[model samples]
Target: MRAVVYDAPGAFSVREVPVPEPGPGEVRLAVEMAGMCGTDVHIDAGGFFSRYPLTPGHEIVGRVDALGDGVTSLARGEPVVADNTVLCGHCAPCRRGEPLFCANFYSLGVNGPGGFADCVVVRAEKCFAAGDLDLGTAVMAEPTACVVHGLDVLDLRPGADVLVFGAGPTGLVLAQLLAHGGAARVTVAAPTARKLDLARSYGTDVTVEIDRSDPARALPVLRAAAPDGYDVVVDATGAASVVEICLGLVRDGGTFFVYGMADEQLSVPLHPYEVFRRELTIKGSFAQTHCFERSLALLRSGRVRTDGLVTHEFALGDYGLALEATRSDRSCVKAAVVP
Candidate 1:
């Protein structure tokens, strides 16, 4: 077997490794397609909850190759999507019915051996039969699940006017979800024109192309789009500068949602007096909890489209190149590693 092993932060290599066998209640997957995410780059730099000696590819779509003892729900050769999140039921947060805040969280690819290999072991219960979904589309289940979680946090009021910043894969998904999830009008802002075009095709009401390096330059244009300000403002770009500037776009008593993965060290200034006077709600959404089933359903129903979402694919040996392109290449919408 072969895998991309990260010995530590800023260090990794594609090397031959022994194939792992599944334990009780687990199954081994023959990796078919593993989606590369911005979080992977974060993990590579020792950010997030990354654990050393990790095989870090979380968005996985594969076929069940072997089943462990007591795993009778699925059969060998079944196509499926694996949920990467693993939580300890005894954690304080879990006991409080908030598994998202579990004290001991172990996400495959972030803090455990993941799908960046030819074959990887995962809990059988986490594997959802993809049914008739295309492999490329199925790879989006993880991210869509995260978007689902973001929507859960936002809880937009009916007919609310919403604005989303960013047109990358997750950003596009978030915009589409907002468009259908109760927002009367959904507007998307990004640096790329083509991505905005894509957003329009996905039911976005309006699209604005802002200079990524100078987001403030488009402030006048954005204000003209909705002079009263948006009922809900979301920053999906994960850029601290963008977040700081867009926070002002939220209407009075409106909500501001942070859906992007920004740097841990980054900080943005907020006016305490304004928040107090406006009665604003500021919320942040992290990785999902028990949302994969809905994510897969949305994808399967074509409500959340995946066409043209996956713009690039790479060989397992070229994982580093894929990661670099994902981080720096604005032209690359989504990158997948075909193991």
Candidate 2:
């Protein structure tokens, strides 16, 4: 099997490795497609804590080539998408029905061998059938599940106004989810004109060009575009300062959802008094949960547009090229690696 291995920070290479077999309560997948995400780049850059010589891909879709002991719900040859979350079912958070907060939680791409190869072995419970969707579309289920989690926390009412920061894959998906959730208007802010155009295609009613160098200057422009102030503000940029700016842009009683991962420490002015006075709700959503099934349903319904989101694709051996393109190409919306 050919896999991309992360040797160290800023280093990755395609190498031949033995194909894995399913273990107890696990399933072995003939990996069909995997999406290149920001997290993959972070892992490759050692921005996150990860073991070296790792295979870092979690946005995966494949067929059930084999099943481990006790696996019965899924059949061999079934198309599936794997859930990254690996939770300790008896942990405090898990007992509370918050598996995402499990004390002993780990993820596929981060904690174990991931799906960027010819074969991937995952826990049986984490693999969900993709029905009749193609491999590429099925690979997107993971990210869309994250969007579902974001929407779950957002709790936006019909006609609520939304402002999405960053027009990347996650942000675009979030915009479409907000639109489908009955948001009256969704405005996407990004530095690149191409991404903004992509966001518009995903039903973003307004688009603003943000100055990456002078992010603060975009606040006034965003305020003008959302005159009444946004009812729901989502920061998917993963930049701490950008998240802070999003918090400031929301209306007095609006909700602010931080869906991005800020790997570094961020210092920002706090307004505890304003939070109390306005009764605002600020929340963070990490990873997907039961939302994976919801994401599949959304894809099946064809309510959200994913066609334009897949702007680039590469062969499994071209993982380096794919990651580089995702990081540097302003026009690339979402890149997939097909094995």
lDDT per residue (tens digit) for residues 1-339 in model 1: 999999989899999999999999999999999999889888999999898899999999999999999999999999999999888989889999999999998898999999889988999999999959998899999999999999998998989999999999999999988887988999899999878888988888999999989898889988998897889999988898789886689888988899889989999999988888887889999999899999999999999998988888999999998998898888788999999
**lDDT for position 13 in model 1:** 98
Q: TM-scores of all models?
A: 0.98, 0.94
Q: Which candidate has the top score in TM-score?
A: 1
Which ranges of candidate 1 are over 4 A from the true structure?
A: none
Q: In order, what is each prediction's RMSD in angstroms?
A: 0.8, 1.8
Residue-level lDDT for 304 in candidate 1: 98
Q: State the displacement of the C-alpha of residue 243, model 2, in Å, after optimal TM-score superposition.
A: 2.3
What is the lDDT of every predicted structure here? 0.91, 0.84
